[model samples]
Target: MKKQITFSIFITMLLLTACQERTTQQIIKLTNPSDFDRVDEPIVLARNIFTIKDIPNKNCIVLDKDQRAIPFQLDDLDEDGQWDEMFLLVDLKKKEQIDIIVMWTDQMSNKQFRQRANVRFANKAGDKILNDVNRLRSTDTKLSQAEFQMEGPAWENDVVAFRNYFDARNGIDIYGKRTKEMILHKVGINGQNYHQLDDWGMDILKVGTSLGAGAIAISSGDTLYRVDLPETSTYHLLVNGPLRSVFDLKHHNFKIGDHQLNINHRISIWGGAACYKSSVTIDGLQGNDALVTGIVNLHSDTYIEEKADQYLILATHDIQAEDQAALGMALLAKSKDVIDVSEAPKEGSGIVSTYLLKLKAENNKPTNFYFYAGWATQDKGYTDKSYFMKRLKKDAMRWSRPIIIK
Candidate 1:
């Protein structure tokens, strides 16, 4: 009877210890007030203390001071093939604090937790005739094709969308939306039976020779040169998420002037944001060479703002598409890396304004930058050019000052 009693006491102590281990909590604080709804902001747990498996079966809850559950999603932002971060989509008032409790008993079924960001790559399988190097086409029947028939890859979030020409010439492009619903569903193939305004969000802006909306280039003396990755280039969808979408495109042995360059490109878009992030890794670059990425100058009137070592904001409000709506586009980078902000005028496409950033590669690591677009017709506040520029500056500052996590 004594042995039985001792065994019972040991089992009870073990149960208490396990319970204590499961109720671990971590607190995150935002120093400044969030200007927009904090969507998919990651709270990465310490890998030493917690493994991916430790995240309870969808039972994680971000709680307020009063211990109420807030909607959140757990995802792998780094795309390491394992879930590692917990994303919180909260509207905390300025200077408010929040608590994230793992292993909580509350299993709240919030639809926000299931929000998705997607990317699609339609492959050409059975085409018998090989098109020319300049031929623009895509195998996917749901994608939009420009007048040039630029068939590449396309991706979108709820608010904004983007696509890259599959051919070897132009840079990345943007698609603006007025509604929060997925617009790719309504954008029919070859611009055939589709709605640009009421449904498709319209490819309102033209890329035309200029960096349509954040296409990359190389600054060679007085010329801004762009390389077109062949349609046969490898593309991979890294992350398709409840909060973020990420993909990579790699081109091997592409000639840029006299040098053959290998490039790795990765693009990511988060929920509730107008801007998408692009990082480019170039294998071959000589000394005194710089990478140029910028917004296209479709309009003659343009405004450039610079903040020493922090950021540079470029804005243009001009007549876009058939409608004369104000369209604002900006490219932001660390001012310290900026070599110069200049314009390269092509005879066929007029003037293309660009930001030149110093490209320093020692061991094949990529140089990073950001590009964004805003259409007045899509959102109310975006009609004002000043408002769009201010939004860019605010976003740059917020990114530089990340939330404090402990």
Candidate 2:
């Protein structure tokens, strides 16, 4: 009788241990250390912060102070089976602290949330459409550009959308939206006309070899070289979020004065914003290399420049949009990173007719910048120069000083 009783006790303890392992909870404290209110601030948490086996594989549940479920995503940044990081968009007042309850479980949740941002990389695969990164990076630039939807990879948030020429030109373009609906996946393909005004919006910007938007390059001396037509390239959709989406592009064998380097650009877009964050990293980097990005200047010679709160705002408001309407574009960056702000030669062999931003970079270090596009038809407030500047400043502050997470 005593032996049977001990066996029962041992079984009960084993079951209890299994149950505890099946479900685990963690408390994450996030503080808005800035004086300004943090509205929809993006936060990233690496999986290395916790023990790998402690969190279950499939489900991640996050709760707020009131036990309200918050929308979040687990991302496998390296395309490995295990998730490497967590993404969440948080809101808090100045100096406010919010405690987040995170629970990992073996069970999945059926909870659904409104999607605010998206990523689309569609290519023709016979009768099927797929995001085959290799298909768009072929040597046949012109043919592939026509075959791919939106001429390349396109991503969007609620009100703003942007596309890249997966071809050798390697430029960025914008699609201004009337409604907050995610519509790029539907409109850009299947013989549809996006150049004209639709209920959603139209392709409002024209890109002509000029960086077009916030496209990047490398600068040596006074000449610039495009990070295009590489020997190999790949596109990865890192995270597709209900509040934010992240996509990455890899360029291998880009030549700069006979020195080859691999470059990676990871861009993230968030909800309710007309701008996107671009982070660029280079392999085989040298400290002397200058990273460059810019806005097209063919239609506007006069640009409004501002230095505010540790950032430089290089912007242009003009009647230069494709629809002949006023559009405002701005590039925001840290003042310290920018070494030169000048114009590429109006008629040159390299990237010309663009206002250039030459940035300081060290070996293998990442350089980041945010690009903004505001169309008058989409937001009449953008027609006013003052309102455009104010919007850029607010966003700059929010991105530069994100909420502190402990």
Candidate 3:
């Protein structure tokens, strides 16, 4: 009689434990329809994509085919207290389909993943102690003269990093990394020594007066004006996480010729990616006004221009880096959006050492493109021009064809 009672109590306790640990899961199906392999391609899903109702924000996770927990981010985009989207970087072979399990529960799991992407911005507002802030404005100073750390905000993944000038230059620069560790967080914290080669990496690009890496401009007829003159310039930090990081540069009351407009430039970078994505949104356009972005052409005499299956690529490779090494820079856009690539003068009232890419501009629409940087020291494979270009071509193809998720 005693043994029977003990066994019955143990069975009831096990049943209660199973119920408490129950997880609601949904099978997510994704297919790669393209012929090329999609490697670590980022997929963002909405909150309501799953059929599960009243999903809790905590204890949410993703599992692969082997039932291994994958690194994923359930981001709260607007920070209104509710989770917004799920961010994941997945791999899929051509025409291959896989099922990913997404599980969530109201209880806690106490799980933490490794961080690979970073978005950092700091300024010396009162005490010059490098206070981190989400928003900042420019005062129209010279290049790299702004009090902001590293001149402005910088974003980085494990592969590469980039920073923009908060001053009048409105220029962008690159930091080719030698290691895969996150370096930007502790870089300026000690002191501004990124120019010199460290154990992690060094600043590789000399921006000068050019468009730097891939800065925006206004091209009207034979004239070009950099996006430096704004009545007010504000910077907003949106996401800083393990898999993705995004920020925005808002130029309020930007006068492009006679058209006064506001420009919002959003830039995002993903983990293990050597490039960053830019989306420019502008309103109030009239007449023949156009938008443009370009690469610095001071050091590279020749550039390769290719029209791929889905996009146009304009690239340059030469001893253009600050370290005097080979650095490959490419700017790509959809085939329908790119009009042509033009060579700007070596010197002018506008800017210098830049080859302009005239882009199709529409009122209240965003212009999108990806800028890639490859330094030889950062990756020895980048020393080969063909390898560098081929890698970018493959990336362009992957960007054109995304994995369809159901």
By TM-score, the best candidate is 3
Off by over 4 Å in 3: 1-22, 56-58, 78-80, 124-146, 189-192
lDDT comparing candidate 1 with the true structure: 0.59
Clashes counted in candidate 2 amount to 0
Q: Lowest lDDT 10-mer window, candidate 1?
A: 125-134
Clash counts per candidate, in order, are 2, 0, 1
lDDT of 1 by residue, 1-406 (tens): 5754654464334335435644435555544345444444533344344443545443454555544455555555455765665555555444555654443423332323445455654533212212222324343323434332224566787778887766555467777776676655445444443224655476666666566777766655555467554334555666666667777777667666667667677887767778788888877776555676777665644556657226655556555533467777777776666666666654454335433333334327677777777887878677776788777877777666566554
Question: TM-scores for all candidates?
Answer: 0.75, 0.88, 0.89
List pairs with backbone clashes in candidate 3: 297-353
Give the poorly placed runs of model 1, Cα more than 4 Å off.
1-80, 104-116, 123-150, 189-195, 220-223, 229-232, 348-363
lDDT digits (tens) for residues 191-241 of candidate 3: 657788888888898887888889888776666778886787777777788
Poorest stretch of ten by lDDT in candidate 3: 126-135
Question: For candidate 3, what's the RMSD?
Answer: 6.0
Taking all chains together, the TM-score of candidate 2 against the true structure is: 0.88
Q: Candidate 1 clashing pairs?
A: 136-149, 168-228
What is the TM-score (0 to 1) of candidate 1? 0.75
Which rank order by TM-score, best down to worst?
Answer: 3, 2, 1
Model 1 Cα shift for residue 92 (angstroms): 3.7
Q: Per-residue CA lDDT of candidate 2, range 356-400, in tens?
A: 888887667889899999998988898788888888988777766
Which whole-number lDDT from 0 to 100 does residue 371 have in model 1?
76
